[model samples]
Target chain A: MKIGLFIPCYIDAFYPKTGIATLELLEKLGQEVEYPMDQTCCGQPMANSGCNRDAKETEALFIRNFSKYDVIVSPSGSCVHHIRDNFDAIEQTDEVRHVRKNTYELVEFIHDVLKVREFPWAEFPHKVGMHNSCATLRALRTASMSELGEPFFSKPKTLLSAVKGISFAAPKRPDECCGFGGTYSVTEEAVSARMGLDKVTDHHDAGAEYIVSADTSCMMHQQGCAERNGVPIRFIHIAEILNGARS
Target chain B: MSNKPVPHAKLAAEFLKDEPHRHFHDERLWDMRQKRDEQMHIMPEWQELREQASRLKEHTLAHLPQYLEQFEENARRNGIHVHWARDGAEHNRIVEKILRDHGHSSIIKSKSMITDECEMREYLEPKGISVTETDLGERIQQLDNQLPSHVVVPAVQKLTSDVAKTFAKYYNTDPNIDDPHALAEAQRNAARPVLLSGDTGMTGGNFLVAETGSFVVCTNEGNADLSANLPNLHIATLGIERLVPRMADLGVFIRLLSRSALGSPITQYTTHFRKPKKGGEMHVILVDNGRSERLGMDDFWTSLKCIRCGACMNTCPVYRRSGGQSYGSVYSGPIGAIIDPTFNAKKFSTLPFASTMNGSCTNVCPVKIDIHDQLYKWRRVLAERHEIPFVKREIMKMAGRLLAQPTMYRLAISGTEVALKTMPRFVLYNYLNPWGKHRELPHPVKETFHSWYKKNRLNKAKQHEETQA
Candidate 1:
């Protein structure tokens, strides 16, 4: 299958490795991959900020870049969700609808499309706790890291729990945002940092060595607080762990 | 203190600067969550009840005009005078007229976000009638002359020391001593005379049961009960969307509301006033104030299903940390983020952007309003109406172009990695990047998947095809 890679703008600019890993992982599963260079963003940052007016140009740009791909895959659940929810704005053309329908978050892409039963790489022995990214958990409806079930049917906690070396520690406030809500971090910095710190503390109190989640944006925020506060915990995106490359 | 409206970023910074207070507040919210979870675990049918309540709300909202008419008729039949207000100003004017007609210059009120929306105190005080908030938290905020920070907690943002200082200043006591209990005593002493002098009491309704022509008010502080019972003229202000089809619905609602809000099985008072006592007159003001228009919009109609449980608020990470003040509205957190826009989009356009769409609010909500989903919908609505910033619009346009194609996406990924690796950190930390303010950007990797995939998967697929050929 020819899979179009959707690299979210932030990942494109900063965390390109996530995009690269997503490409390699799909190929390792024997799926043909294509990169659409025109792809810049999922319009999430603008849309989430109550600036969909700003998203129009990006929405048009997204449609123009990835319209031809048979299957669209991105590492970020939040971005994929933005596309799924907002593609109608760009154009309700059947082609746009097809791209939106085919676009999948990496885990859902791997689990459902590829149906991989075993990790190709070896598993690490360390115990890892997972944080469910709000968009992926709520929007994409990814499996919960804390429970076991169908990945797409339940919250992302379930899906995170399925990864090897991953043991789920229930959040004190389950399913709460870690407060790294894109622009919210800057606009509401004090509250955002405090929320991120609270989530970090919760993970630390749970005796987690590493906090894994699907969204890099949230991990970035949580990891910053941990690093700044000299907290011992580490953060990794679920894609990095799921790719099993570190092992 | 500036005459200009306080930007959310500045407000958050001020809140964050008080590290000790933020810590205490977060800790208290966490404790509340623990208590709520424990309570939820005891009831196996809790999730079911949530579904039922949600369905009931959905049904009521779908046929809102009918239910509203039904509510008006029942309330009128019960000897309660009913009035409708088209908007905030109208609501305030109608309320003021009623108070004036009843010869009430002073009123005791429970916490009501509706009043907050209408700026009722600002309206009433200017008219020479004093409106005293009776809920402990509301009273505290009222005394301090600040908005209630959180919907349920109201005073969650204020530390006990802050409360003590405010009380000391008000009662002419020493500010040096900071004791919450003493401060509570002081407030109680100070408020008693005001309560006695109050002629009318007002409270926000939790649910206005259409069948009984009555409404239920829930509160932990017993303020609503006291304010209602003590005052000769009792008035309840409720949004038109607050109605339930039957009185039996209260059993489901009352059971879930407190548990979801604060983890209590029920609040200290869950008073249901169907009719006024013989000497007293009970009045119900069914305020539209933009709800009927919101009900007309399909995307946001679910927001009307909110029980105001504050479970969504309690579980909201943004709300828990930021407190309620940052949303710049009476409602804060997930539910507030969505609903606030419906009530006042221009004022609260930034609310939806205030948090990551963590599904916690949706999951924790007893009535299950799909708050995060509504936030997403509101983004589209806000965007369609040109509510978002200009810079964000251009960036999204650039992104939408790049994401739709596979080849460009690959080129962009490879190019971005090389740039980030060679570029200075400050370049990535520019003002345009919100993440740059507080987060370290993740380092890009050496090779992208396209290069690795072409070398591995495509080659292997070619070999398999060649073999087949």
Candidate 2:
């Protein structure tokens, strides 16, 4: 089966290691992965800002690029969520429907589709707090949220537990948002920063040396908050740890 | 209506400037959310109860007119005067006429958001009538001359010290008093006399039951009952959407209301008012006030199902960090973001954008209002109507054109590495960039993934193909 890797714009420019880790992790699991270089973005910034008309051409471009693959996977949960749910800018052709249906966030893809149990090469001895982006937590139904009193189940934790020597930090408010909402960080800068600071502080206070997540946008904002406030915590992508990064 | 958007972002920024207030507000509401979750944990049928309440509300909303007419008929037969108000002005007018006809010039009222929405006090104060808020938090807000920042806890945004000062100004209490109980005692002492001497009393209806022509008011303070019973004249105002087809449906709603609101199993007072007391007159004003028009709105009608439990406010991260007064509406937070625009679209346009669309409000809603989804829809509606700001619309359009073309998008963002290296942090991301005000920008990378892929993977694939050929 063909796998199309979707590296979002910020990931492509700033956090290339995360994109590299996702690709390498997929390949290490004996999957054929291809990064379509012409991909720019998923039009989330436009559509989220309530400009669906402006999002049309970008969404069309995305559909044109990813329609041929058996499944399209992205390292960012928010982008994948937009592709699956809110990518309604253009016409709903067969290609659009196909692209939307086959799109998956990398963690869910590995946890559900690949169903890989053990990462023999992956190990991290440091204590890290898991950050679930709102898209992954609520929109994607990835894990049992604290809001819904269902039996506790976490797909990301299920996949991460396979790694050896990894310790977890239990924060006070584990499932709260980190406030890296695309464009929301800039638009509502004060509250967004306050929330990000509060999130990293919670993890740090709970003895977490690092915060890990499947979505890099949240980590990027969180790292910014930590560094600015001298919070003394680090950030990493879940793909990096699952792909056996030792740091 | 004013076309200017409420300065939500600006006001929230100002609210954040007060570190003490911001932390207290966030932690206080977050504690309520935790308590709510604890309640959910005990009730195995919490989700099922929420579903039942949502279905009941939707059914009532679907046949709102018939239920309202039925309620009016039953209420009239029960010796209660039923009045219909098409708008806030008419509601205020009807209220004024009722008070004037009864020769009453003063009213001691409980916390009713509907009266606040109608600006009833603002309208009546000019005409020699007095309005006193009887609920403690609401009384503090009235004394301070500020809007109730929260739906359930009107003075939750104020610190205890702030309350002491406000009370000291009005009730001659000690400004140095730090105890909440003492403050409550002070308010009680001041309110008891006003309750007795007031010529009229007013209460807001929590649920209006059509089957028995009775309305329910749930309060922890029992102030609603005092406001309704102390005076010979009683006035209860409620939105028309509060109707339920039968008294049995109250079982579903009453169970969810306080549990979802304060995480308590039940309110201290759940008074049911069926008819007038002996020789006392009772008036029920069914206020439409744009609810019928909102009911016709396809994307927004479900917002009418809200029971004013304030669960959405407690769970909303944005509303917690940004004080509710920042919303500049009587109804604030997630519910307000959707409902306020129906009142005045241009005035509350920025309200829908105040959220991150995290969808927590939808989960915590007892009646299951799709609050975040409605907020998104409101944004699209506002933008379509040209209610959004000019610069934001233009920037989105520019971004759309640039991002659709891959080459152009690459060209636009490719300079960021150089810009990051040359520009100082403040110069690059400070005044011009709202992101730099409180957070550091991401560090510059030596090689972006695009360049690395082309250099390594693309070249390796070409080399393998050439060798094979």
Candidate 3:
């Protein structure tokens, strides 16, 4: 399958290592992956801020860049979520529909579409807490949320379990938002930062050496919180771990 | 009202300044959320109950006029007087008239959020009518002259010391008294005389059963029962959306209400008011207040399905972290963020944006109100109506334009990188930087993915293409 790699603007700039990991991981799985250099973002920031009309140009450009690929994958769950769910600012043409239907977050792409379980090259000895972005947990249904009282299942955890020497740290509220809600982190910085501090502290107190998540957006905010609050914790994207980054 | 939006973020920042209070508030609500999950875990059919409750609410709302008429007719047969209120002003007027017609000078009411919405106390106080709150939490809030923050636990955000201070001011209790039981006793002592002296009683209806022409009031403290039966004149005011088709349907709600609200099996008192006691007059006022207009909203109509169980608020991380008072409305938290907009779009515009849109509120809602989704939709509605701040809108416009063109986006990214690398610490972290106010900025990177791809994969792919050609 031809996979179009969507490097969200933040990943493209601040967290290039995550983007690199995603590309390498896909390549290692023996799938054809293409990074369309023209792609910048999935238009989540504009659309999520209630400026859908403002999002139209970016969203259209997104379709223009990735229309021909069989599937579009991003390391950011929120960006993929925006494309799959809220990418409605532009007209619903066949190309738009095709991109929306085929776009997948990196974890879901590897777990559900590719169905690749074992990561032979990946081994993480550190105890890590899994942070599922709200978009990945609730919107994408990648895992069973605690609120639903359903049988417990986690796609991210499932994939991580397959890795050698990987143990999970259980935070009290594992799936609570890390408060890096695109524009929300700045707009409501006090509450947003407090949530991020609490989130990092929760994992830290649970004895986690590092926090792993599928979305770089959340980890960016959380790393800032951890560093500022003097919380002794580290952060990594799921792609980095799955692609066997030694820590 | 000034057209200025409520500064929820500012108020929340203020709330967070008191670390102990903030910690207590977050933990207390989180405990309720956990208990609610425990209740759900035991009930094997919890999701099914939510579906039934949601469908029943939607059905009744669809035929609201018919159910309302049926309720009015049957309630009259049960010796109840019914009144219709088109808005908050009308609802207050109806209540005031009921009190004045009976020559009543005082009313002892239960914890009714509808009365708060109608501003009944503010309206009636100048008319020489006194209202006393019988619920412990509400009485604390009433004595403190503050709005009820959480719908279920009105004083959940208040510490024991705060209550002691408030009671000391009014009930002549010691300000240093730290025991909650003693504070409750103080309130009970002070309110008993007022509860006994009041000539009229008022309670909020939790459910208005159309089939039986009766209403149910669920309270942990049995305050509603006392408020309804203490005087010869009883008034039950409820929002129009509280109707259930039959008594059987009431069981579904009753089973879900306390479990969702407080994680208890049921409230201490789930009293059914089918009729007035002999020689006592009974009145039921159905208040629309903006509910009819809200019902007409395409994306927001399902919000009426809210039973006000407050599960959404308890489960909401934003609501838990930011104290409920920060929302600056009678209804606060996830439910309030959606409902408050219906009252005044401009004044409460900031409420919708107060959420992180985490979707926990929607998951925890007993009736499945889709609260977080409504918050998301409300932002779109407000933006289209120009209710959002001009600066934010303009910024988004610029961001959209910058992101649409890859060339400009790359330029801006590199520009940001250079600025971050070269800018002074004072310049980077200043009053204007909300992100830097509490958190550090992401570290500057040497090469972005775009640059890395160009150097590594893009060149290789180009070379391969040439070789194949």
Clashes of each: 49, 0, 0
- Residue B427 Cα positional deviation in candidate 2, in Å, after optimal superposition: 1.5
By lDDT, the candidates rank as 2, 3, 1
Q: Candidate 2 on A1-247: residue-level lDDT in tens?
A: 8999999999999999999999999999999999998899999998898888899999998987899899999999999999999999999999999999999999999989998988999999899899999999999989888988989988988988988888899999998888878888999999999999999999999999889998999999999999989999999999999999987
| lDDT for residue B374 in candidate 3, whole number 0-100 | 92
Interface RMSD of each: 4.4, 0.8, 0.7
Native contacts kept, each candidate: 0.53, 0.77, 0.81
Could you give candidate 2's per-residue lDDT for residues B39-70 as a string of tens digits?
Answer: 99999999999999899989999988888889
C-alpha-based local distance difference test score of model 2: 0.92
DockQ, each predicted model: 0.39, 0.85, 0.88
TM-score of chain A of 1: 0.88
RMSD of each: 4.3, 0.9, 1.1
In model 2 chain A, the worst 10-residue window by lDDT is A175-184
Give the clashing pairs for model 3. Answer: none
The TM-scores, one per candidate, come to: 0.86, 0.99, 0.99
Question: Chain B TM per candidate, please?
Answer: 0.92, 0.99, 0.98
Worst 10 residues of 3 chain B by lDDT: B219-228
Q: What is the TM-score of chain A alone in each candidate?
A: 0.88, 0.99, 0.99
Q: What is the C-alpha lDDT of each candidate?
A: 0.74, 0.92, 0.92
